[model samples]
Target chain A: MVPVEYYVGLSAILFTIGTLGVLTRRNAIIIFMSIELMLNSANLLFVAFARTFEALSGQIFVFFVMTVAAAEVAVGLALIVAVFRTKDTINIDEVSSLRG
Target chain B: MAPVNLNDLLTILPAVFIVVWACVLLLVDAFAGALGKRLTPWLTALGLVVALVLDVSAAGVQASAFNGMLEVDGFSHAINVLVLGAGLLSFFVSYDYLNRQGIAKGEYYILMLFSISGMMLMGAAADLIVVFLAVELLSIPLYILAAFAQPEPKSEEAGLKYFLLGAFAGGFLLYGVALVYGATASTRLSEIVAAVAAGLENPIFLLLGAALILIGLGFKVAAVPFHMWTPDVYEGAPSSVTAFMAVGAKVGGFAALLRVFIVAFPSLGVDLAPVLTGVVAATLIVGNVAAIAQRNIKRLLAYSSISHAGFILMAIVPYADDAVHRDTAAAALFYLLAFALTSFGAWAVVMTLERAEGKGLELSDYAGLFRKYPALALAMLVFMLSFAGVPPTLGFAGKFFLFRAVLEGGYVGLAVLGVLTSLVSAYYYLRVVVIMFMEEGKPQAAGSPLLNLTTGLTALGTVGLFFFSQPLLDWATNALLRLF
Candidate 1:
């Protein structure tokens, strides 16, 4: 029975948290978690809009986004594991070899 | 609700064929024995060759298929051919490189085909949702391929970095789509255009959506601010994947960008012009200037690619402020082809120089390359010169048309800046040539002859195209005529 604004507010909070984490966290894993949060925030917004507009297309899009996010998460975690094993650090600052 | 006819089937045939071929490869890999791992790349290459032929045959027959989610204009047709050609060549060079590196498998080609399918779809997409899906489709596989060398720490890092940034870009793009849909009550490009045409003046939502969409694509194209991931990921990924990325992925990104902006956001030109100008200007200056400091050849090309994105962004200007300038779009398409061929040739040479042990090729390592590998050195020289936009080469010809388009569109200052940046970029590109021709090879340089058949043939094709570029230009102009 909650209005649409509540969902919007929740997603906004999630998205802000993600942004803060991406900016502040130095650990690669935490940064990745922040990315997940960002994606989930969008997913939640999509569902809210789908409910508001009574459109199946928005929900369908959410499904596709979730699928891609899962694929990305699996592959991303695997990569972090590999990099950590090689360099012995999950800190984002330590992975500076690829940076400018 | 109606049954399909030959026309309907013909329209979707190219995408369907690629999808079927990809699925076939996937199944064969899962079920077939050693042959799947060993022989599927050749099979996949053959399938792409066939699909390219079919796609070319379907050109110039404009039709909407799959409920108008897909479009097959001459422009999309041209991009499809280029993408498929790039994929086939990637397959060709990959076979040798993968065999040498011990990562040869059916899955690699399967993922490549799937990625290409996404690209083709994106190029033909007329809807915002379709565009979003297509970007993800094109990108997800690339992330995996970037790290396909699971044992290599650099490869893993490349994959993770690309994934994080790509997903972030996707979120921006999706949010834009949602806002656009909220404003226009439709995700279809045609519907949005109609609504705008019908006097919808909600500039706030439109401008915000358009800017977000541009940011997302800017990331994909490696334009200035969003291009932070390019050098690192390009350096860390395998050379072949990097080569494929520097060509195929770029064509897809620009093709989608051109379509969306020209078709959807053309009405917003009054607001978009200044913002886009700033982006193009900064991208040109930053890409060229930063490239000068890179010691790694891969990172240099990455920065060069960002600069190329600036040049491509110039094509968006006239259309963003004016009508669909077919000449400018045509010129941009030609530049895309020229850039693809030249950059692929350059990266293929880089791949050839990298030994099986995965040792990176530093810029200084090319010292005395001319004496040791004369043909490769010459081929590499052609690619580097072409990229630097030197005379009579396709790169020069491409830039000539691109700047001419901008001039015709009345962006003379931007065109001049583009030329000036090209002059600055010549320094680093020619540095590779200097190290090859002017310097002496270090004594540790081995005599391993670098006559990689697939990559060498690709280089020859590229170098020869520079001589025969006029016909291609004519063809590109003809393909672009449809957009007008």
Candidate 2:
């Protein structure tokens, strides 16, 4: 019963929030979470659009996106752990050993 | 669902071979222990060779498979050869470097193979979902491989930075796909083309989607403004990994770019061409001018590769010009091949000369390299010349084809800018050559025969292919013929 425009608008707002979070966050974990937020927002839009059009492909795509996000989390957290072991911090600014 | 056929399975046989072999190798490495680590590189190389042969043999079978999710054709075949060849060269170069660095493991080869399969799929994918999957499949392994040297803090940092940016780019790409699907009610490239031809339901959504997709792919290819991750990632990661990423990622990104823009969005050309032209110009200016300031060799080459991305972009700028589309696409393919060989060769030399703790990375470390290793110096010189688009090398021929395509498309300004920027590139590229031969300092290099063989072969290809480029050009032309 909900209007499709409202769903799209909510998705846009969520995506923007996620983008800002990724841009401003200094902690690597938060950035990873923000990326998840962004992906989830896209999933939300995908579902809404799929329902509106009654197309299964868009819904199917969300499943793929979620699976990929989970896999990314696995790899991303491992990388963070690796960084923590060596650098003793997850703050991106403090992890600056390589620069031009 | 339609019943699957042998033809459908055969169409994606190369990628299937790689994925299955990579998984088997992963298990073998876990169980077999040290022997697995020793044999992994050779096994990985063998898998790539077999896949390459499969790709070549299936060259004549051009059809969409998996209900139009993927298309097997000349374009995919040509790009597969480049990706697989890059994988082969990376394997050869990594064998000794990994051992020397004390990080030799089975996962390295497995991850490389996994990523190569992803890249090959990118070349074949006909649906946006497949494209997104392929990109992630290629990139996730690279993120892990970037941090493969677990104890190295810089490598870890590189991995994290690459992952964060890569995830952000992936988000943009997914959003773009959603928008496009909403507008066209389909994700298949052929279907999208038909919809656009019939007139888009919402042109604004389609345009925004196309631009977002470009942003996502631009990040992958390291185009200017979207290329922040490249220098740090390339510099901090191991040289062998950086070499593979430089060629593999660029080729994969461009493969999708060519297909998505040319095949799916040709009707949107008038609106998209200017944006692409701007991207091409900025990539050239930023990628080259920035390289001049870098003192580190890896960082310098990273910037050079970014500029090379720009040169390759020139070939795609004319994607909408039907008169020149095939030629331009072929030119782009040829340029990718040339750049891959040259980059692999240069990085192999860098990997050989690099010392523990990353001590021999500064430009001054390369001073007097000629005295210690004349053959290495000569190989580096050839690579540098090739990068600068000098004569008697594939880079020259590749550039000639690209500029001709640009000129044919009536973008004389871009062609001219390409020429001028290449002239500027000559200064930095030649500086490496000048340092290797003219400057005096003792730089010891490892005598890894495999590494030496990689460097020698790529250098030989760089020069030999210049004269024999007609066959490659013909192959590239044939590849695009089916696409159009």
Candidate 3:
């Protein structure tokens, strides 16, 4: 069987990349995609740990995470569209009128 | 899994009622058009009032329902009352503003009901899965509400920014849950604590998980370092939505933080205490210091709200010591009540002063408000004093209890810093009072009777509750999470 550590290592790398993308990306769409990546990484961790511990609860948690992520995609994309309609730009920097 | 029972259903009755009512309200709005639009707010109020009544009826009852998924206790009951009350008041303050802005719709109240139900569930959630679901339920509606003024770019940007940041934090929270589950082989909070007491498969994972969870919640409450999106979101969202979000969201976030950390992870308290203390300190310094620079009233209040989060954290940071947990919990709850009353009153005043198209939001616009409306100004003065923790106000009582609790827990330095920061916070809070009474500028106000009623009632509660809140204080004291 593939080792659980390998799964953890993969998820950790993906999570780090996702975090970096969210911090650095300027495009609203890209930032949102990064957030999805981060959520999937956690899902990967949950599945890995569930297998390692032989528990159904962790696996069940992943289903809820997937459901939430789908709902988020619906809202997040709608928001991006709303921003684009008004500002005509999806760049986070250009959307900056309310800043101090 | 145990089969669902009648008792389990009763345990989560308030939240269930809200969800069911929201669905029914959606159908009512969809078929009814303008009639539905007008009926929505009243119906929403009716539904919330029903839930509030049901919640209070369950006050003396306690149970672990849904086979340990939901908890019915004083803690949950208090949170239900707070969030429901905030939701209902938001409607009152919002009624005129929403119509005036020409954005009055059935959806607004529906979204709020969904969010309130989520918050109520947050207080009662005894399992991690439920907590995660509750957070999403509360937040998604708010993201949409923040942008409800769109095609106004500011509102849309606020919605998008809040969504991005909130989704990112949810990732962290999910990872934290996964890690904690990995360490303990359980997702139930009560079971997690039991496992920790017995010993964990890995302690490192637990610590890391808790830290990540803290980061997620910190963002929700707008604590410093995690608060980058707060000012812009608060400034951009419609004023009525901002007011509701400010009170309701904080109540839910803090409720979960207390239950998850203090109830589920008490074993890690000694280790997490220093970290929480540092967060409290930074939140106080940064939240207050940044507010001094804000010209926009909404952004300033956002920062003030953050600093209040810090003072409440002072009580929470000391929960590691068992001897002090009850006192700290009570302090935190009382402070939340103070913040809710004072915050709603101040926002009602802000809403009153706001001109069409969000023009009258600058701090300078508040000048000369006292000349036209003496009663309104005095009520605003009471709100400002309460927020500044001045004597003969609820804010003072809240702070006194919080600091005393922290001091007893041996965090003398944090308590002292809390005091110093209160002095610093007073400068900015009082700035509004000065602008209203002393300065000169013609500030137009909507002067809606509903708005005035909100301001008067909350203002009265702020000062009167301070002096005559012994029974309420006793209730807060008894509102502990002892379900295990």
Candidate 4:
């Protein structure tokens, strides 16, 4: 079996990738996907904790978090579509008329 | 586990009721629009009104519900009313603005209902996960609404900026929760308090967690340093959305801020209070000084909001004892209510002046406005004067109470700075008034859509508030007395 450290390491790596996406990606969709990745990493950690602690609540929480994440993805994607339909481009840099 | 009691169910009844109402409105709008033109927004407003009535009727009934995931009290009830009232006003203001702009979709109102429901629940949430979830529920819809102004590049930018920064803040908050959970082994505020009381020798993890959480919420409330997004977002979003966000979102943010800092981590106040005081100082200084230079009216109001966050932050400073805490909390709560009314009215006036292509409304554009629209001018006067803390207005009353609370808490220096900033703020606030009454650089004159019943009521409520300050102050004090 893969050790707990392996799972932890994977989560850390995935989280870092998500963070990089958030910081560098100009595409709103990519940024959203990055958030999903970060959330999934958290879920992975939660599952590992549940397994290690022999607790059901942590796993249950993971399930609830997954449900919420799905809802967030749906809403976020819908917003992106609306934004794109308005501007005809998904370029984040192009939409800077609101600056102070 | 014990079975749910009537009191337990009653504790969360408003949230449940509003959620159901939102879902029903959404469904009805979907099918109704397919059949004919949907009347779901009006229906949603009616449903919120009913839920608000239920919330009011249940006032003063304090109870913990759903195994302590939620806690309902007069404080939460009051905030709920403010948020719902904001929703109601937003609906009325949007009715004209959206139709005129040709984007009056029923889903917007449903989204607002969902958001307000989340905000109501957030104020009452006692568990960390529940608080985070409540925040998300409130925020997600707002992100959409921020971008909902179709074909407007600025709207899209506002939504994206808010979403990105907001999501980043959320991550910090979540990580903080994780660390806190790891440290205390529980996410419930009661359990965390007990654990802290039980005395961990080194509270580094707890302190770090609180700091992260504070940063997260500081962003939400648009406190300075995390407030870079506020002006742009406010300026770009539709005026009604800006008004809704300006008042409703801040109310929700303050409610969460009060609960988290005052309740969950009460034990850490000794270490945290001074840090927060510094933040308050910075927020006030930055918000006010930046506002003085703004040419765009919306951006100016955004900076004004940041300064108000400073005043509210002053209220969050942990007291030397419970009495001082109660006093300051009451001041903050009352100030928030007063701020909501005046700010919304100010934006309503701005919305009223919006042109057909929706391109008018700038600081210079307000020149000699009083000559054209006297009633609108008078209403605008009330909003401006109150914002400047002129006497016999709710804004002045709010400032008085806040300064009194600061003095009582021995923050004499902070109170002095607050007064000084108030004086500085007068320059910008009075600039609006002067532009209206004195300046001759004429804005291409146009007729204001006569104030509808709801906007009229909102303006009246703000103006009439000086008469009601005493009773409102009493209720706020009483509610806060229960908190500590």
Q: Supply the TM-score of chain A against the true chain A for every candidate structure.
A: 0.92, 0.97, 0.97, 0.93
Q: How far is B370's C-alpha from truth in model 4 (Å)?
A: 0.7
RMSD (CA, Å), each prediction: 2.6, 1.1, 1.1, 2.7
Candidate 1, B317-434: lDDT as tens digits: 8786444467778888889888887887787777777775556478887888898878778888888888889975788888988898888778889999999999999999999999
Indicate the residue-level lDDT of B369 in model 3: 86
Query: Candidate 1 - CAPRI tier?
Result: medium
Q: How well is candidate 2 docked (DockQ)?
A: 0.84
Which candidate number maximizes DockQ? 3
Alpha-carbon error at B319 in model 4, in Å?
A: 5.5
Better of 2 and 3 by DockQ: 3
Name the runs in model 1 displaced over 4 angstroms: A1-13, A47-54, B1-10, B321-324, B356-360, B442-451, B454-456
For candidate 1, what is the total of clashing residue pairs? 0
CA deviation > 4 Å runs, candidate 4: A1-21, A40-55, A84-91, B3-8, B33-38, B319-321, B441-455
Candidate 1, DockQ to 2 decimals? 0.54
Alpha-carbon TM-score of each model against the true structure? 0.93, 0.98, 0.99, 0.93
lDDT of each: 0.82, 0.91, 0.89, 0.80
Deviation of model 1 at B320, angstroms:
2.8
Query: Taking the tens digit of each residue's C-alpha lDDT, what string does model 3 give over B183-249?
Result: 8888799899888898886899999988998998888988878989999999999999999999998
Per-residue CA lDDT of model 2 for B1-484, tens digit only, reads 7978887887799999999999999888888888876777888888999998888887777888899899988889888999999999999999999999988888999999999999999999899989999999999999999988878888888999999999999999988888898788889999998888888668888888888899998999999889999999999898899999999999999999999889998877888888899999999999999999999999999999999999998888878788888889899999999999999999999999999998899989999999889999999999999999999999999999999888987889999999999999999999999999999998989869999999999999999989989898888888888888
Per-residue error at B387 for model 3, in Å?
A: 0.3
Inter-residue clash pairs, candidate 4: none
